[model samples]
Structure formats: structure tokens, C-alpha cells
Target: MYVAVKGGEKAIDNAHAWLAEERRGDTDVDELSIAQIREQLSLAVNRVMAEGSLYDPDLAALAIKQARGDLIEAIFLIRAYRTTLPRFGYSNPVDTGTMRCDRRISATFKDAPGGQVLGPTFDYTHRLLDFKLAADGDAPHAPVAAPRQEDTPHITEFLKGEDIIQDEVFSDDTPGDLTREPMAFPSNRPLRLQSLTRGDEGFVLGMAYSTQRGYARNHAFVGELRIGKVSVEMDIPELGFAIDIGEVELTECETVNQFQGSKTEPPQFTRGYGLVFGQSERKSIAMALVDRALRWEELGEDNLGAPAQDEEFVLSHADNIQATGFLEHIKLPHYVDFLSELELVRKLRREAEARMAPKEAAE
Candidate 1:
């Protein structure tokens, strides 16, 4: 991260001071509160948390403010800060089936179990900007209703009843954590899911779109998409049981993909799943597509040589922190490397000219 520049430490200090001034902008305007960003610009906060691999919204909001609304920079700050924290223990796996869903929908079936609850979404709204928001007016609170008592069954359950889709087999084995262990290739589904969940939203989105463009097509239907609060549990050694440590907002997506069965199995649909921190519908959907794309071999489908199918490529390039580190490093002066390349090119051109001169004179 060293920049080749004159005036060293004092110059860097002054530059930071200038940056702080720029971040504050006008003196007349009131400073933005962390709570405002957490509540109002919640989507941005969610994105930062998802990419940063941390669940603290207040911290995410603070990072967003400190980074001056640059989400990637905020994520970098959060990640760097997270490295200093002591790890007490890992939380047990969350149960999405019992989620207190705020939003839920399915594209495959018109009316699936628990019905379509279009909680807070901009899907039906006009795309044009409303001048009302500019006038410091907030929308009036809408009427509320009691949450449904009936359990919301997943769309896959119905499909599973008919034996038309592959069943989700739960394994007793503990899933691997990429951060805890050195990431090695030929990874399992859990490790891949972990990478994809925290992967760059734009990168994952592009990979998903590529699959739709017939580059390793896995015709997928949105089986179910739900966003809600799920309890985070941790096993207590003394108690000899798991306890709910906290709750986190999560977005879960399950895609029903077309899978022609192999010799050992029956002709039925396959599944692609995405479960991520916060209400990130786009990220979750993109994750599901890429997840399915990566499962080509396991599902007995031939790899169409797509970018999403390459586990190492997807896993390596998916991380925004790592990606930005590599990308932003080029901003620092490459004086020696550039000068060396310049010299090589000049020497090769001179040699070519000398050979051409002899040829021209002979001619």
C-alpha cells in the first residue's frame, strides 16, 4: 500500500485532513447520524455487512459514514477491524424454516403455501423520482396486521412430496470455514456457499446473468425467496445444549433447476440454494444461480466451460476485499516495472529497424 511520493508522512497527513473536509462537505448542513444510515440507507448497510462478513449493523453504518458512502471502502474497514476481535466460538447453523419472514415470494407457483407476502419492496412502484422526498417528508406509516400463525412450508417440500425434485440430505459433518482454513480447490458445497454468500454482488450478478445467456444454462425457477429474522445459536459446553445467542436478518433463495437424472438416480428437478445476511434479494438470487452452475459435476451435468463453473476462478475472484486489494495496488507507482518494460520495447524496436535497414539497402 506504499505510494511512491515526495513529502512522505506530513504530506499523507495533510491529504487525510483534506479527505475528512471533503467527506463533511458543507458546514451549513447537519452531519449524518449513524442511526439515519442504519435505518434509511439500510440497503447500503446490508451490502456492507454481506461483503464485509460481519453482522453488526451499527458498525456497518459507522464504517459507511467513515468511508463516506463508499461501500467497498466501508467493507474493507469493517474486515480490517474484525481481524482484531477475539473469536469466542462459532455460532450453530441458523434454521431458515422457522424464520419470522418479513418478505416472501415464489415464481414457480402462483399461490404456494403461506401465500405471497410482498413486504417492503419497490417492485410495483413507478421508477420516476418523487419530489416529495426532497422536501423532507417521510411516508406515513402503513396499517399493520398480526403475523400468520401457520407454519410456512417451503415450495420445495410440495415438489418433494411428488418426488419430482431432489431431496436436501442433511449431513452430520461440520462445514468448513474458508477464513479458518486455507482455501483448497475441489471444495465442498458448504465452503463454496460460504464463498458465494460473501462474494462481490456485482461479480455474482454478472456470473448469474451469463448462465441465462446460454453459457452453461441451468433453467432455474425461483422456488422460494424469503427475507426475515433468524436466530443465531451457539452450543454451550457447560449447559450441554445450544442457546439462541442473537437474531439476524437474512435473505434465503431456493431455485428449482432442471436436472436430467444420472444412471443411479431418477429424472427429477435439482436445487440451488442461497442464504445470505440481510435483505439482499439480488445477491441471494445471483448466489443461487452460481451455486447451481458450480454443481454441474455433482448433478451429472457436463461442464460447459463457463466462468461460474470454474470453482477456483469464482471463489478466488468473488471476494471484493481481495479483488480491490489487487486492483487498487496498481494505483501506486509501478516505476521500475514500467521503466523495464519501456526499455525492452525500445531495444526490440531498434533491433527490428536495424534489420529492416539492411534489407532495404540490399533491395
Candidate 2:
């Protein structure tokens, strides 16, 4: 009766079959199409795009369906799919100044030039359950208006006019992608922002909240938050020109933080910047807060031993995919390591017991 189990291959096959069946769900009912997920579960699709660093809604939707609606799994699918695709070239830095914004608001000011358009938000909705949505439900239609062609000016840029906000020195430097290249220490703004954007929303939120709770308490005022679509262009090196590849939705947040002026510098306000791949305002805002906290050194502020101020700590552990994969991988076979430890403990116990027996007999 001491026979060892030997169904690893069969077990794996059965698991796969079960997963496929679960994903499909209810053979009598129509299979949930990728289009259905994309249109119906758009917020989930957005989360996948934001975290996955890919903007294909359809593919994200398919990933959601295949993942049994697990948002993180959907993001992983998109990320894996994205890694296999060929890259042509980099696009010019997106001018948020000239962005065609669908939604834009500034917290620093009561009113701004571009004007606040509340566009598509669940902010004001009560948490009461809408019972109708328990099943497939029809949504109400809203009046559509022609898209505005006028260029949108950033709220931060307006503050720059009054010297109220620090004007970021723009450079033609092309920052290295963290995904393509291994993340190196002393990361630049672009790399830091990139990591924060794809970072887990809840983790970032907690870290940001920590700053407000007396940890690296840099008084932060939300300068602006914008959600909109922007064209992504890739340069064709062979053709010597850039072509419009596609467009993506982005959430951008800029936070105004207190800055103590240096010897040669004037007393001016500092900024924390955040930008993400989709309409993820919460992530963007959290990212901005944490971004400012991480800049304590550059701003010549004392490190208050805050977790948010520790760049090595925060940036290293920010990615959920990396964290989850490493943490969960330990669930697999480690019997060999366990056996070694077990043997050591048993040997040590026997040696200690044998040594004590002679002393006890003498006593």
C-alpha cells in the first residue's frame, strides 16, 4: 500500500480540460465572445491594458475570458502576448500639451483655460447594488457631440507661467525601457514613472497613503488629472519617417509637492509626475504621491526612514507579476530542501540527547 502516485501528466491534462470547460461555462448558453467582454467589461479591460502595458482591448478581453475574468491573469496574458510582438522603433515624446483630451480636470485651480470636462467617471455613483446588472442589462444612451479639434493645454504648464510649479527641463534623451533592459539603480524620471504606472494599484495606493500618515509627509496637492487617447507612432527607420501605428488611452496625474529651495535655487514648488497606459486615475494619482516621496534626496530633504522614500525597496517590489510569480512558485516541489533540513534537525537532536544522558546518570 506504499505505492507512490504517478499521475502528474494525466493530472495536468485533466486540469487543463477542467479549466477550458470552466472558461467556456454553460454549454446550452452562447459562448461569451471576446467582443462581449471588451464592450461589457471595459473597466476590467482597462485594468489589463494599464498593467499589461498593452492597449489592445480585444486581446485583453479575450485574455479576461480565458482567465475566467481574473483581472491580473488577463494582464499577464496581455503582457506575455506583447513580449512576442516585433518592435519597429520609438515614437517622439508625446506632447501632452497638444493632447486631444476627452476628460481633463485640475485640482490646484477652481477653473482653468481648457475647462473641466467630467467625462466618463464612476466618482459620484452610490455604492448601492444595481440589481438589474445582476444579469445582462441594457445601458441608457447619451447624446453625442462632435470631437473638439482645439489643442488641450496642461494645467501644470499654466502654473509654470506664474512660476508656481517647477518647470521640468525637457531633454531629447530617449530613456531605456525597463522591460527590454534590466532595471539599473539611480533610475531616471522616465524609468521610475514607467515602473510606477505598471505597478499594482493597491500597493501604490497604500504607499502613497503612508506619506500622508507622517511618513515622508510631503504636502501634496493634485495639480491635474487627465484621461484621454493619444496616437502612438513608430518610426520606420528604413523609410526615414514615423507612421501612426495606433492610439491608446492614458491617465496622467501631476502632483505639486513642497520643495525647500537650495543655495543657488529660488524657493519654488516641486512636482511628482505619473502617467499610465489607460484611464487609471487612481493608479496615476497614487503613482504621483509615491513619486514625490521617492524624490526626497533630489529635493535635499532628510530621509525620514520612510518606505516610500526608499527607491530600491519600492521600485524593486512594485511589479505584481514578478512578485506573485516568485511568491507562488514556492508552492511547487521543495521536498529535497525540506528533507535536508529534516535530516539536520534529527541528527542534532540525537547528538544533544546522547550528550545529556551521561550528565544525567552522573547526577
Candidate 3:
């Protein structure tokens, strides 16, 4: 029998106090402001917002500051806060076709319709550390071209014209929210995409890499990757039309994989889709690969039993918050459980000794 531990409140209070002190290291140095975090660490803020499933940059920055720059913890804070807000109405899905694209590129074709506009990408940049950035030196801005307002055509569209790509029929059915409803087995594409979009970036990246290393290898080529702002519209029954709610930055990736055919269907290239909040190209690309791996059943491909191919496994472990909680719980006191295990081990050892002693005496 174990007695309950007391004085948890006092201990917690002291721990919080120490944490606060530690968060504000060096009183002489200026503390990091939320604005500074938002402006300077925008990528971190974007990642937190993407994983947290919230679009507010300000709240994400605050969460980052509160979490002491831990992205996962910041995501948790944002997710916790998001649950308190009242839902007005669901916004209509933004049309990426009409997106005001700042960057658009394709690997399938050297020359595409939009002509491979490489906007603000680190693709060609050398991985050398710029020591000049350490010191506060003003850098010259790259020359900007006039803004292109024309809608850039999707690379898949060109393939579709030649009937080289498999047709994706659009559905009017509403997508299920994983946050609101319990996930059932054999989830659909929408649910799988949702899970991947909010999944831990590193975990998703690793899973994608596994596929490239011959674990359910689906030869994926970047069909198109576009980063831009899309207007979100909300349908209003009173107004008799949808009104523009807001605009948000999004990164959309479509991967074209190897051709697949059957007795009934002709050979055509299949596709994997990924769309994420903010300018997260790497996450979007990884998401596309994982998405394709998870679509084995629907695409009539063999279930290779890969980690990325397992829907239940992917969905179950995607959440960092839940993973962190269970992992960290091991640090908590388990005195009674440990004692029970110790007793069992001792009993087993004693039983073995008694049995061995009789054998030795007989010998």
C-alpha cells in the first residue's frame, strides 16, 4: 500500500517560479518581445501555426515565447488556446487555381506555363554559414520583378490534357474533422491529409525518406509546388452569397508517381496531393510522399506493410503532444509498480535457487 504524496501545490508553484526565472535568462540582456519573435523568427511561428492548426501569427509567436522556443510545446499551447474560441462558420475551401502565386516551380517539365518562377526558395543556396549575418550588417535586397497576377496553370493539367495522368473526380462530400471526431480505421484521403498536415515535421520527413530508401517506393516527381495567398470565403445564407473572410499563405504540392494500370483501366500516372498553411515547401513535399504511401488501397497498389503505408500507425503516432505526454509520463513516480515488479523478480530468483539446491545435494 502506498500513501498519496502531498504538497504538490507548493512544489508546482516553486517549479513555475524557477521556470519563469530560467525563461528570462540574464537580467542585463533585453528580453525577447513577441513582436521580435513574430518578425525575426517567422519560420518558427509558421511551423507552430501549421502544426497547431491555427493561422494566427501573433498567438503563435506568443506561444513560442511562452514555450521558450520549443516548437512542439508552442504548438500545444496554440492548440489548447484554439479550443476556447467560439466557431462562427466554416469557410469555403480556397481555390488554389486562382492563387496569387509568389513562387511556382515544376520538376516534370523544364519549361512550364508559369516558367518556373523560383520565388524566395533556398533550393540553389549554398549551405555555408554566413558569418556576416551574426553581425548587424544591412544586406542588399534582391531585385524584384513586377507582380504577376495571371493564374498559373497546374502541371498536372498539362498531363491531363494528354490523358497521361489518372483522373481525380472531385467529391461534394464534407470532409471529417479529426479534431472533433474519433478517428475510425481505414481513414479516407481527406482525413489522412489532415493528419499529415498537422503531424510532426521531422517524423513526416523521416517517413518520406524511408519510402525513397525502397520501403513502398512510389517514384514521385514534383508535379507542381506553388506558394501563395488564397482568399478564404464563407457562405452566408442571410447575404445569399459567400463573402471573403480573409486571405492566408499556403504551400501546395502535387506529386506525380509511376504509372499504374489494370485489366479494366488504362495505364496512367497517379498523384499524391498536399496543401499546408504558410510557406512550408519541405513539409508539403514530405506530406505528398506520405499521402501517396497511405493511398495503397484506393489506388489498387500492394500493401507493402511499410511504416508510411500503415494508416492506423501513421494517424495514431502523428500527434507530437500525445506522444510527448506519454513519453514524459515515465518521469512521474511509479513506486508501487516498481515495488511489485521487484518482489516478483525476487520470488522468481528464490524459486530457482531452491530448485537448484535440491539438484546440487542429490549430485
Candidate 4:
């Protein structure tokens, strides 16, 4: 009734050998260095770090090289490696208010306290292919104004003063980590935000797009987007004070959505928050939109059953690694299962034919 295939060990070894050769194509060409990937392919490294939930660029770059430039695979490698490392202690929440901003912009206000600084953005670039880049790939640097010394206050804070935006309630509750525990239904805002931050950028983007296309539409305006480095500190029990551990680059986005009013609450602009590692404006913006969409019930807005509004659906399918693993697992051996199904179908057909033959003879 069943058969087991043997010699898989030898076949697997040969396949791995072939894969190693393919990964290092053209032995004459110099292999890509991890440093080159860290510096030159910085965005790729940033993405792997963001999705992997690890901040080490060097390790992220090494993972990229080992995965042969497959970013999702690189993220998977980093995540797998991260679990083996021993946990020392959790760092205190980094303060974005004191961030040393390299790029800050507010769409809500044309001119705020700290003027808009469009640093290293492709927003204004024309979609023209420069032939020069293909040859030498060197470009002249443009002059920039001196960096602002004063700390730029959040644009939402300005609206908060006038009670125009709904105030965010402060909480000391420890958020649940999905990685440590299984995800449950009806997740809170903190868990939702965590899922979004580590979620696949393209998947989050599509869900956010659905909200904009009249499926639980929340008219969102870019309140502010900031990219900078924030100092990380940890409280050492022996030292009696928090000490700076290091600094990490982060992108924070705040979106102002349509005003909501109820019998218990006054009409005020609602907010959606997005924070991610490195300069990921598009992902951050998309994240904010989806975050706000998921808060329909909390904001007293009717849930129109949109994909973005469904927390269970979004959070469950957001991780590309999980999605890919299950999807690609279908390629694995299923001969036994197929044989069982075949036997059942044949038995059912034989029984049906036996019954039909008796009826035909009587006719």
C-alpha cells in the first residue's frame, strides 16, 4: 500500500554542491564582499534589519551575502541567528523627541518650527535614466545648508495643544511579543503595531492601498515623517542610572486621519503611527494608513469588513517567511497522500459501477 524512496541523502548533498557553485557564478569575477553590501546596498541591509528585528548592519549584510542577495531569505537567516544569541536585558524605549534628525518633513504644515529638510529623497527626481550612471556611477554632490540645532517638535503636538487631535493615552502595560508566544485573536494596538513593523513591506502596502480605494477608507494626511538616529539606553541595577547603549537610525511617521465624533467624545482628528528601522518612508506611510484602518473599532468608527480592518487576517498572513514556508512546502513529497486519494476514488468508482450494472440489466 505504500513505498518509501531511499538515497535522498546523496541527492541532497549533490544538490547543495550544485547550489554553492551557482551562488558563486563565474569564479574569475571577484565575489561580493559583506562590506560592499553594507555600504553600497545599504537599503537592502536596512530592510533585512527592519524585518529581521535585529539592528546589526554587519550581520544583516553578511546574511544578505550568504543568501545570495535574496532579501527575504536574508531576513530569515538573521531571525534564525538572533534566537541563538543570549538575551542580556531589554533597553528602555528610545526617545524620538530627542532624535538627531537628518530628514524631517511635515505635510500638514508648509513651514513649521524646523523647516522641511529633504535629505537624500527621490521625490523630486525625474524618471530619467542617466547613461553616465551605467558607465562610472559617480555623481556630483549638491551643497546643503547647516543642520538645525533646535529639536523639532512633532507636528501632532501642535494640534494636540488646541485639542484638535485626539490625545494618545499613556500606558505602562508591557506589550506581548508574538515571537515568544502564539498570536491570539482581537489583538491590541501594541501587538498590531509590532506585527506591522515586521510585516512584509509589499503585503502591508497592498492592504493599505485597499483602505485608500474606498474599502474602509480613512482620509489620511501625512502629519509628519522623520528619519534620524535615536539613543538607546538601558537601566543597570548596579549603576543606579540608565546608560546609553548605542544609537540606531529610525524612521517615524504620523498620519492625521478624518475627524471622529461620538456622544461620549468630541470631534477630533485621529492619528496613525508608524515606526521602522532606517529610512523607509514609503513603508512607514503605508504602515500608518493600515494602522489607522485597524483602529476602526477603537476609534468608534464602523468596521466595513475591509481586509486592512481585519486584525486577525492581516497579522496572521503578514510575515513573508511564514507565508513562503507553508506555500513552498507543497513541493515536498506527497506521494503517500496522493496514493491514498487515488485508492479511495477507484473504490468509489467500482462500487458505483457495480450498482449501475444491476440496474441496467433489470432495465
Per-residue CA lDDT of model 1 for 1-363, tens digit only, reads 343667578988999999999999998999999999999999999999999999999999999999999999999999999889998799877878898888999999987879999989888999999888889867789778876986677888899888899888987788898888978999989999999999999999999999999888899999999999989999999999999989999999999998777756678898899988999999999999999999888877777788889999899899999999999889777777888889999999999999899999999
Worst 10 residues of 1 by lDDT: 1-10
List residue ranges in candidate 4 displaced over 4 A.
Answer: 1-6, 137-139, 351-363
Candidate number achieving the greatest lDDT relative to the actual structure: 1
Clashes by residue pair, model 4 = none
Please report, in order, the local distance difference test score of every candidate based on alpha carbons: 0.91, 0.84, 0.89, 0.89
Candidate 3 C-alpha lDDT tens digits along 41-108: 98899899999999999999999999999999999999999899998878887899998898899998
For model 3, state the Cα shift of residue 69 in Å: 0.8
Off by over 4 Å in 2: 1-7, 135-137, 144-149, 262-265, 355-363
Alpha carbon deviation, residue 47, candidate 4 (Å): 0.9
TM-score of each: 0.95, 0.91, 0.95, 0.94
Candidate no. 2 TM-score: 0.91
* Best of the two (2, 3) by TM-score: 3
lDDT of 1: 0.91
Which residue window of length 10 is worst by lDDT in model 4? 258-267
